[model samples]
Every structure is written in C-alpha cells, then in structure tokens.
Target: MAQQVRGVIARAKGEPVRIETITVPDPGPGEAVVKVQACGVCHTDLHYREGGINDEFPFLLGHEAAGVVESVGDGVSEVAPGDFVILNWRAVCGQCRACRRGRSQYCFNTHNARQKMTLADGTELAPALGIGAFAEKTLVAAGQCTKVDPAASPAAAGLLGCGVMAGLGAAINTGGVTRGDSVAVIGCGGVGNAAVVGARLAGAAKIIAVDIDDRKLETARGLGATHSVNSRSTDPVEAVRELTGGFGADVVIDAVGRPETYEQAFYARDLAGTVVLVGVPTPEMRLDLPLLDVFGRGGALKSSWYGDCLPARDFPMLIDLYRQGRLDLDAFVTETIALDEVEKAFERMHHGDVLRSVVVF
Candidate 1:
C-alpha cells in the first residue's frame, strides 16, 4: 500500500520549500522504508532548491538523516524492521570494478529505490542525492541504510550521513593527517571544523583553522584547533607558514570549495605535503593554477567525495565514538526546527547564523 505523508519539497527553482502531502510507496525488491526521526538542513538541500545540482526540478530535499527501518522488501537482508540506521547516499554495489578491488568507497555504481516517490497530483520527485529524507517516511535501497548505535541522539547521528562525515574523512582518510602532523583547514564551516576534529583525533600537533568569520574560528578552536587564523585580516598562506615554523602545515584542507580558498590551501602546505579539497563547487567554477606549482609541490592533491568514506566501515565506528563522548556530534547541531520551518532554516543557513538547523519529526 502507498502511504501519504507530510514532506518538504522545492516545487520550483528559487521558491521556498513547503510541506506537502507526498505518497511513499511500499518497499519493493531490495528496498526498505524508513521512518525518519531527524534530518539536517544541509547546504546541498539549499542548492537543490536553487536548481544548482541539475534540471531535476521538484526535488525532495534532505539527505543528512537518521531513521528506523519500518519495513523491508523481498530479498532485503542488510537491514530489518526496528533497526536504527543512518541514511547514506552512496549505497555501494558490490559488482562495480572499484568494489571488486576492495575500494568500495569509490564504487562506480550505487543504489536508490526503484520506484518513484510522487506528489499528491502524481508528479514524480527527484530526491536530493537519491535519498529524499525530509519526510515522515522515505523509501530507499536497503544498502542505503547503515545500522548504528540506537542510543546515539538521532539529531547528531544523522549528521554522519553527510557533512560531518565529509569533514572527518577529509582529514583522516583523504589527507592522511597522522600523529604530530601540522594541519591547516581553510574554512571554518561545519565541514572545516570537522576537519579540525579529525586532525585532533589523529593526534595532530597543531591544527590551524582559517576562516573569515571570527565566530566560526572560535568554534573551530573549541572543537580542536590548536591555532586560529583570520584569513580576512591576514594572508592565510603566510600566516599558516608562520604558525608551522615557516614551512607551512603538513596537510591543508580546503572546505570552502572556492578558487581563492583552494589557492590558499595550495600555498599554505609544506612542500611535499598533501592538499585535500572537500568543498562543493559550482559547475561553472574553474581553477587556474600554474602547472609548474602543481608539479613542483611534490605531494598529492586529492578531492574527497563524501570524504572517501565507506559507510559500512565508518558509520558504526563513528557512532560508537559519538556515544562514548570522544566525538562531539552534538556541537554541530545549532538548533532543531520542525519540518515546516525548513524555509526559515535556509535563511539562517544563508546568513551563517547557525551551524545546522535539523528537522525533528
């Protein structure tokens, strides 16, 4: 049976999202229906509303989410009813070449529900990142659900489905910040601060946070930054070098995803050091760096996709850390809002007034 439930959707480009009655169909083969408990208002959701991702209109927003499995379709064994799970956009297909090589994080093929979710008038919705979770209930591929500790707060645990995981993995997995390494994170947004936390967890000797906003810098320091740089007032590359014995940081992460910030990251790392780009950029955005600089750097320049995370391997471990008080997932949540308040939350996010405004069901 199809169930009609309240959901938030961007009916058209540049329009405010509104609560609408959406039809969620029962799970089919290899699919499962999730009873959403919490979903975060991510910048990507805003991007969807603005039609930045693609021409996929009427997007069902919200991807960073946590929920409980309500039902499973035939042949679904990865999750069962009543299982607490975090929804992930990347549901690795084991048969992909990357998965066959044991690097499922780079799996070329991912999974989504076979059936389409639709509006009351029967207009099919394009789900944000293939997981339309900003609803009371959503249907997803069984592999999209990563079971984790049920005791973890749904609001905090849900974040691991996206931004937080991206940041942490940017530092730990992509940049390879190890013990005693000096790391500088350019951009003190949620993802940047998570890089700081990841650096600290990796035992970084000095974690330098660079951002235009003083408030975000302060937040980064509290999270784990050993030093802070106001990039607006100072040359970030020079400041980072001065903070690291004039050799720059061992690793530099660009979380803002702008050409200027990326340039700063390029010049702010030590020669033979790594540079990781985790920020999302627009399609028209381009980078014009000197080819000599790229060759002379003598280290890796990597782009992190979903923090290069393998959900099956990372989510449960991170959730456990969150439960043990090692990881402060709660700090990322600035406030909680109802589903109807999503448009208002977007305004707050645009103005940088909150780190995250999660929708609690």
Candidate 2:
C-alpha cells in the first residue's frame, strides 16, 4: 500500500520550502523504503531551492540522512527492515566499467528508486540528489542504504552521507595526506573542518587552515588544525609556505571552489605535492591560469567527486572510528531542529552561523 508522509518540498526556484503531504509508493524491484530518523540541512538543499543545480522544480529537499529500513522490495537483498542505515546518493552498479575495473568508487552508473513520490494533487517531486530524505519516509535504491552501527546518533551518522564524508575523503582518500605530511585546507566551513580532522586522523604533522572568518578558523583548530590563516588580511599562499618551512605544504586542498582559491591552492603546495579541489563552484565560475604554471608544477591536480568515496567501505569504518572517539562527528552537529524549521536552518547555514542544523524526527 502507498503511504502518505510529510516532506519538505521546494515548489519553485527561489522560493522557500514548505512541508507537504507526499505519497510514497511501496518499493519496486531493487528498492527499499527508509523511515528517516535524522536529516541534515545542507547547502545543496538550498542550491536546489535556488535553481543552482537545475530547473528541476518542486524538488523534494534534503539528502544527508540516516534512517531505519522500513521495507524492501523484490530482489532487494542489500538491506532489510529494521536495519539502521546511512542514505547515500550514489548506488554503484557492479557491471559498470569503473566497477568492473575494481574502482567502484568511480562508478559511472549510480541509481535511485524508479518510482516517483508525488503531492496530493499528483504533481511529481524530483528528489534532491535522487535521495530526498527530508520526508518522514523516503524510497531509495537498495544500494543507497549502507548499513552501519545503530549505536551511532542519527544526527552525527547521517552527516557521513554527504559533506562530512566529502571533506574527510578529500584529505585521506583524494589528497592522500600521509603521516608527517604538511597540509593546508582553504575555506574552514563544515567540509574544510572535516578535512582538518581527516588530516589529523591520517597523522599529518601540520594542518594549516585558511579562511576569511575567524570563527571558522577557530572551529578548524578544535578539529585538529595546527595553524590558521585569515586569508582576507593575508596571502594564503605565502602564509601556507611560511608555515610549511618555506617550500609549501605537501598537500593543499581548496574547499572554497572559487577560481582565486583554486589558484591559491595551486601555488600553496610543494613542487611534488598534491592539490585537491573539493568545493562546489558555480557554472559561471571560470579559471584562467598560465599554462606554463600548470606544466611547471610537477604535482597531481585532482577534483574530488564526493571525496571519491565508496560508501559501503568508508561509512562503516568511519562510524567505528567515531564510536571509538577517534573521530568527532558530534562536533559537526551544531543544533537540531524539527522539520518545519528547515527554512530557518538554511538561513543559519547561509550566514555561516552553524556547521549543521539537522532535522530530527
């Protein structure tokens, strides 16, 4: 039987999201329905509301989430009812070229549920990132539900579904920061701070955090930054070099996603160091750097797509780390709000007032 549930939806671009009664059909083949326990209000949700992602209006907002499996459809063996899981947007298809090559992290064919959740008027809702989880219950591909330790708090664990994972993966997986390496992370937002923690966990000797905001820098320090630079008043590249023995950091991660920040990251690394771009940029954003510089810099320049992570492998391991108190996932949850407070949470996020304001059911 179809279920009626309350969900947050953006009826149009540039409009505020509102709670609506949505109809979620029973899972079809290879799908599962999740009863959401907690969902984080991410910048991506705001982007969806603003039409930054696409013209996909009437969007079902919220993606970063943790939930309990409520039901599973035929052929869905990945998850069963009563299992605690963290929802992910990417559900890798094993037969894809990338997966067949043993790099399932780069799976070219990821999927979501085929059935549409609709409003009472029968208007179709486009799920955000194909895992709209702001609702009381959301339908997703079985592969999207990665089972994890239920002892973890829903609010903290759900964050691994997106930004936190992106940041951590940017450092540990993408940047390949190793023991005793010097690292500089630009933009000390939620993602950037997570990178600081990642570097610390990876045994980085010095973690330099750069940002225009002092508060964010302070947060980064608590997360494991050894040094901080206020980029607004200082040249981040020079500061990083000075902090890293005049050569530059071994790894420079640009988490701001702007061209200027990207250039800063490019010049803030050692000759043989790595530069990882993990920030989300606008379509109109462009970079114009000297071709000579690109050739002269003898390092790897990489873009981290979702931190180049494999959820099934990373999520569980990270949760274990969190449980052991090695990872401070709780620090990322600044506050918790009800579903109706999502708009206000977005405001706080845009104003840089909170790392994350989660919606708890």
Candidate 3:
C-alpha cells in the first residue's frame, strides 16, 4: 500500500513551500523506499520554488538526505531493508555512453523511481533532483542509495547528497588540487567553504578565501582557509595573486557561479592553472570573456556537475573520513530545523545567515 506522509512541497513558482500530506507509493522494480532521517535545506530547493531550475512546479523539495532503506522492490539487490544510506540524484545507468566510457560521473542517464509521489488530490509531484526527500519516507531508484557508515550523524552524512559534495568535488575532483598547491576559492558560502576544507584535505599549502561577507570569510578560515580576502573591499584577483607569490593561485574555483566571480577566478589563477566552476547559474547568465585570453591563459576551464562525483565511491570514503575526524562534517550544519521550518530556512539561506539549516526528522 502507498504511504501517506507529511512532506514539503513548492506548489508553484516564487511561492513559499508548504507541508502537504503526500502519497509515496511502494517501491516498484529497481526501486526502494527509504525512511529519511535528515534532509538539508539547500539553495536548490529555493531555486525550485523560484522556478529557477525549470518549469517543474509542484516540486517536492529537499534532496540532500540520509536515511535507511525500509523496503525494496523486486530485483533491487543493491540496497536492502535497514541499510543506512545517503540519497544521490545521479544513479548511473551502466549502459549510458558516459558510464560505458568509465566516466560515470558524467552519466547521461541517471535513475529515479518510476512511480510518482503525489498530493492528496492525486496531483503528481516532481521530486527535486529526482530524489525528493523532505518527508519521512521517499522512494528512489535502488542505485541512488549509497551505503555509508551508520555511525555518522544523519545531518552530516546527508549533506554529501548535494552542495557539500559539489564544493569538495570542485576542489578535489574537478580542480585536481594536490599537495602543496596554492588554491583560491571565490565565494565563501557553504560550497565555497567546502572547497576550502577540500583544499586542506587535498594538502593545499595555501587556501585563499574570497567573499563579500566577513562572517563567511571567517567561517572559511575556520574551515582551513590560510588567507582571506573580503572581496567587497579588496580586488579578489589581485589579493589572490598577492597571496600566491604575485602570480595568482595554481587552481581557482568559482563557487558563486556569477560571470563577475567567474571572471575573477579566471584571472586569479596562474597562467595554465585550473578554474573549476561549481556554482549553479541562472539560464540567462552569460559569460563574455576574451577569446584570446581563453587561448593564451591555457589550463582547464571546467564546470562540475554534482562535483563530478560517483556517489557509491565517494560517499563511503568521505563518511569514513568524517568519522575519523579527518573531515569536519558537523561544522557545516549551522542549525537543525524541523520540516515545517524549511521556508524560514530559505530566508536565512538567502540572507547568508547560515551555512546550512538541516531538517532533522
């Protein structure tokens, strides 16, 4: 039988989300039902509310989630009941060209449950990121559940489902930050701070943080940024160049996703240095850079999708690192909120008042 559960849903564009009695169906073949323990309030949810992602209104918000498998449909051998796991948006289809090429991180075809979770009136709700999890229970493709250390806090572990993973992957996976490298992360939001922490984890000798907010810069410092640049007062590119021996950083990441920040990141790196863009940008945003500079400056210009991560491989390792005190996952959780508080959480996130407001079930 389908389950009736309380869930957060954005009924229309630019409207506040509401808690609705949602219907989650039993898992079908290749799918599993999970009891969500925690779901982080992410900017993406707000974007969905604002119609920024797409016209996929009546969105079931919240994707950064961790939970336990409650049931599985036939042929779902990947995850069984009682398995503690993090929900991932991208469940790679092995036959996709990207997966077949072994770059499953860029999997063209990802999996989601075939069944739809609906409102009381039988209106279908489009799950945010294909893993709507702002409820106590949600259904997902069996492959979307990545088993992790059960001892880890659900609030912390759930973050790997999205933004945090994007930031860390921006530095470690996309930017290829290495030991002794000089890295500069522009924008000290949750994602940018994660980049700072990831740079530290990657053994970066210097991590230069840039942001307009001093509070965010301080947070970045706490997360292992070696130097801070208040971009409001200082020219971030010049400051980064000065911090990195007047030659700019080896790798510069733009987590802000704005063209201005992207331009700063482009010039804030050494010639032939990498620039990883992990920030989500609006469709209307355009990049107008010099073609000559693009050719002359050299190095990789990359955009990270979900941090170019393979959830099954990265989630467990990162969780273990968190458990061992190597990764400070707890630091990212600014507050624990109830599901109903999601709308207010969006307000705080908009004002840069919190790094992450997590919904603890």
Per-prediction TM-score to the true structure, in the order listed: 0.99, 0.99, 0.99
Candidate with maximal lDDT:
2
How far off is residue 211 in model 3, in Å?
0.1
The deviation in Å at residue 124 for candidate 3 is 0.6
**Tens-digit lDDT string for candidate 3 (102-182):** 999999999899999999999999999999999999999999999998999999999999989999999999999999999
Q: Give candidates' CA RMSD values in order.
A: 0.6, 0.6, 0.6
lDDT of 1 by residue, 202-283 (tens): 9999999999999999999999999999988999999999999999899999999999999999999999999999999899
Between which residue pairs do clashes occur in model 2? none
- Give lDDT tens digits, candidate 2, residues 1-361: 9999999999988888899999999999999999999999988999999999999789999999999999999998888999999999889999999999999999999999999999989999999999999999999999999999999999999999999999999999999999999999999988999899999999999999999999999999999999999999999999999998899999999998999999999999999899999999999999998999889988899999898999999999999999999999999999999999999998898889999999999
Q: List candidate 3 segments past 4 Å from native.
A: none
Instruction: Give candidate 1 regions above 4 Å deviation.
Output: none
Candidate 3, residue 199: CA error in Å? 0.5
